[model samples]
Target: MRASEDAGLRDRRRELLTGARGRVLEIGAGTGLNLPLYPEQGIVELVFTEPEEPMARRLDERAHARSPVPRVVRAPAEDLPFDDDSFDTVVSTLVLCTVGDQDAALREARRVLKDDGRLLFLEHVRADDAAGARRQDRWHRPWRAIGHGCNCNRATVPAIEKAGFRLEHVERGTVPKAPKIVRPLAVGVAVPA
Candidate 1:
């Protein structure tokens, strides 16, 4: 089931990242799973922010293995170690739900992105359905304990909007073979207005 869920996530991530170009910053680059999916054309450079030491090491190894090496930094999303407006694109995949402070992380993402820069995301968020929402609330506590503090109940889209981004495109749906309660996946692009 986990494998199937991961496969679904990979497909969705690929679709969302297809047209990425220029300097891109990817938050929570866990194990660098998204590294190989990046588009070859248009993208000039890639930067990854990962706080976990082990994961960062793996990401570094993956970057070095790539034809064009990507920059990998060990840092938290809420406090980016970069100049303001430093990237043409910012991306987060399955990241927002585990952030210690979603608003702060989002603000950092907005700060690093250029005025017209795009924010692309592939996140698993709280369900909009009432029954599903209830189920999510029930499962989230136990899930968080085992899933590295990740919550299935975080409303990622609204949080992004509240952090001062204008949604340009959005597609939400359930990931295959996963519990409907916690499988509300949102893929979209936003920009700071």
Candidate 2:
């Protein structure tokens, strides 16, 4: 991921995290890649949820090195253990594609976020053009197998709306250093509708 990070993924993380504040919950925070990009202040607490044990272990190690270490929990996005309206912000970066149940995970994100909280996200979504989208469909199975369950063809924007959020801002772009089939991206902020 360092190659991806260096190739503009890190910049996207920085941009997406710029507005994050108060208590924040990050879903599917694999290995804590976004940890270093969070703002230096404003956030009172940071919590990360990762269901995969190996990634969680690495997240724990990386988190403890920070000045105010983030709390890492072993949980899946679909079954967040947080109370309703528990966080002022919820972040999802390159995660929605791989979740076992994308809608359930998003609903859980909406469930935990305060009514006025933001959902800052950067996710690889289905391509905009027909040819590119068809390519994603064609390669999805192989990509999923190689990417370890990541489905690069998800229609993520509509899913966000369906899960009870309204898009406040969105930018359609591409992921650098990623395969063409998985490069289309949606970076945005949404709030509970």
Candidate 3:
């Protein structure tokens, strides 16, 4: 997934994270892909949280080897161990689709973010077409099981909007070489509503 995503997406991730500043928290850090993208000068600190033990260990190892170390915590997105309005930026990348509770996790993101904080996201979402959406739902159970709880047909955009974040920008596209049910993607920034 990482290799294919990088090969296809170009500089989208870099474009999204380079401008991030102040105290930042990234949910579902995975293999710490976003770790190196954040700017060296503006960022004060970075906290990466991952629920999966294996992924968290890898994230720790990756962050440890980097110049500016990030504090990695093993925790689910729905239950972040941070104070209210504690961070300046909250980031999520290719994670919302797999989160067990998308609504709860997003609420947590909003809670931990300062009033002026922004949420940056790159997520695969449900298709716009009706037939494709049905296919996504039809295959959801098995897909989720195989994809580590990922809802290939997840409605990420509406979920984000419903989380009460005032969207600053959002762009939709398709992932290359992926099935139609899992191809739709959304990338953007949002602030607390």
Each candidate: RMSD to true structure?
A: 1.4, 0.8, 1.3
Question: What are the clashing pairs of model 3?
Answer: none
TM-score of each: 0.95, 0.98, 0.95
Model 2 worst lDDT window (10 residues): 1-10
Q: Which digits, one per residue and each the tens of the lDDT, describe model 2 over residues 57-167?
A: 999999999979899999999999999999999999999999999999999999999999999999999998999999999999999999999998999999999999999
For model 3 the TM-score comes to 0.95
In candidate 2, which residue pairs get closer than 3 Å at backbone N, Cα or C atoms, i.e. clash?
none
Model 1: colliding residue pairs: none
Per-residue alpha-carbon lDDT of candidate 3 for residues 1-193, written as tens digits (9 for 90 to 100): 7654666753777788975789999999888987877788888889999999999988999999877788999999999999999999999989999888999999999999999899999888998999989999999998987887888988888888899898899998877667677888888999999
lDDT of 1 by residue, 74-131 (tens): 9999999999999999999989999899999999999999998999998889898888
- Report lDDT (CA) for all predictions: 0.89, 0.95, 0.88
Ordering by TM-score: 2, 1, 3
Which candidate achieves the best lDDT against the true structure?
Answer: 2
